[model samples]
Target: MKTKFLLDPNITFLNHGSFGAVPREVFAVYQQWQRTLENQPVRLLGRKLPSELRAVKSALGSVLNANPENLLLISNVTFGLNLAARSLNLQSGDEILTTTHEYGACLNTLKYLAHKSGARLVQQPVSMPLKSPEDVIEEIWSGVSPKTRLLFLSHITSPTASRFPVAQLCRRANRAGILSIIDGAHAPGQLEIDLAEINADIYMGNCHKWMLSPRGAGFLYAGSAVQAILEPLVVSWGWNVDTPATPEMGLLENLQWTGTYDPSAFLSIPAAIDFQRKHNWINVHMSAQETLSRFLHRFSESFNIPIAYTPEADPYIQMAVLLLPPIKDPEKFQNQLWCKYAIEIPCIEWQEHQFLRVSYQVYNTEADLDRLFSAIEDLMPSFLTTSSHTKSGSL
Candidate 1:
């Protein structure tokens, strides 16, 4: 599996959550699109690209259970949320509710919009060691009030790697007349997603992260009910709003084309989707879970650092955040792992605490995680103040 990707074999890359490794076949397809576009730019971009994009959307739509007409191929989740946040006409005293675990960029988008509209962006803190998904639903919904006009949240939180109960939350938001916009950056390839079942007003996800595609491959989905409310980020040729002179042009016309831009990545959606289908991602997901579960158990047993996810609720899947023992300098610890161990993972700082995030994809194995465990054990003594860092094993 690792050979099928272009990632360096010298590095133990456990950070697929950051930017996904593209399959060789998908990369070939992406390159092919670029070459084909250059062959006849006008013939393809002006004439055939729209129809080709419709096919890509159709394939992706089937995977997401969303109408192809409702989806638009975008650059990334950040871009998609930006469009959604700015389009919502919030008034003074209106509030957008979210959680502390959301990706910072998405939160910034909401914050900027709220500030512009004289509205409030309420970031509700979710309790750690969650008891159940119901607890999550309650924690976020408790932030809602009559002032809450929208609920913006991550399907799978970036920092913590916890999958929120967005579907249930969306259902709840629907009852209260609050719009739901889900940042599904980590949801599409990691889990089985159904946009219709989730029923969010707007959803944005990246194919580049977990879907085994190149960078700049992402999409935004807006249900027909909220499509009319969206405003394009760039005022290009397709900025036709609902005017008497022109019929209401949907997202296809309004935000699809911005200018002369390279869309090879966007055109590679079908290849990415096909790669997953051909690989039996279901079995791959299960295998990754099994390996991740073992590593989580062994590391917790040896290091005495409790895993972030609640054991029973288990809101997490492959990606995990382990709160590290206090270190003099978090950057040094991370640097040592890369420089000495050749391990590629993220050392995160969230809420005044340092965390080590692990993201194992299909290419990873138990041996890979075992190497991580051994490296941490070998290096822990130098990083820790005391010689011990464990509950019963050592410290």
Candidate 2:
């Protein structure tokens, strides 16, 4: 299974949560699409691209339990999120409610929108050691008011690595007439996503991250009611004033055709989906979970840092966030891990506590976790004791 990925065997790549490792088979398919596009650019882009994109969307929609008509393949989650954010016709005194644990890029998008619109950006602080899904919903909902026009949240948070209860929040927002936008960048492959069941007004996911697609693969899913509000971020072939709209050229036409660009990543989505299916990703996920649980247990005992969630109410599926002792410099420690040990992982300082967000893909094994544990054990003293020792000397 490890041979399937292109990641270097010498480096213990634990940061799958950051930017996913593409399977070699999937990368081959991605390259094939690129070559096919380059062979006859006009024929591929002008003639066959639309139909090919529809097929890709159909395959992706099948995995998400969403309608292809409601989906548009964007460059990435940030691009999709920007489309959703800029589409909202915000006004003064309105608010966009979100959690404090959102991905920084998406949060920045929301902040800019909020600032431009004179809408307040409320960061509802949901404390650590999360209790339950109901509790999460309640805490977020508490920030809502009559002026709350939109609810934005991550399906699986980037920094915290906690799975948010988006379905319940979406349902509540619907009832309250507040539009819901979910950044499901980490959800598509990490969890079973049924968009129909989730029923978010505007949902965007990154196929490149968890779904094992090539980079630049992601999409935005808008419900029928919200589609009218959305205009393409880049207006090119999608919205031509000269050409009249046809029945077939409906929502997809409006959002899909954003000028000529490399559609290889978009076209490779089906191949990636097929790859995951053929490999029986459910079992892979389970094995990863077991490994993560074991690693978390040992890491907690080793560092005296607690795990954020419990089994009965676990938010994460294949990822877990390890609460670390207050390191004087988290960025330095993270860099040292990469530079010294060739251990790639994300360490963040969120809400005054440091956390290591570990992602377990099929390629990772217990031995990988063992190596990480050993490295941390050996380096903890240096990271904690030498706060001002700027030199990258041996511990």
Look at candidate 1 and give me any clashing residue pairs: 388-395, 389-395, 390-394, 390-395
What clash count goes with each model? 4, 0
* lDDT tens readout by residue for model 2, 1-395: 89999999999989998889899999999999989988999999989988898899899999999999999899888998898899889998999999899999998999999989999999999877676888888889999999999999999998888888899999999999999999999999999999999999999999998899999999899988888788779887677678745546676557787777999999999989999999999987788778888888888776666777766568877888987766667888889889999999989888866788898998888888888888888888866745323321211
Per-residue lDDT for 206-260 in model 1, tens only? Answer: 9999888899989999988888777878877777445411225455546888788
For all candidates in order, the CA lDDT equals 0.85, 0.87
Any idea what lDDT model 1 has? 0.85
lDDT minimum window of 10 residues, candidate 2: 386-395
**Candidate 1 weakest ten by summed lDDT:** 386-395
Best by TM-score: 2
TM-score of every candidate: 0.95, 0.95
- The parts of candidate 2 lying over 4 Å away from their true place are 241-248, 385-395
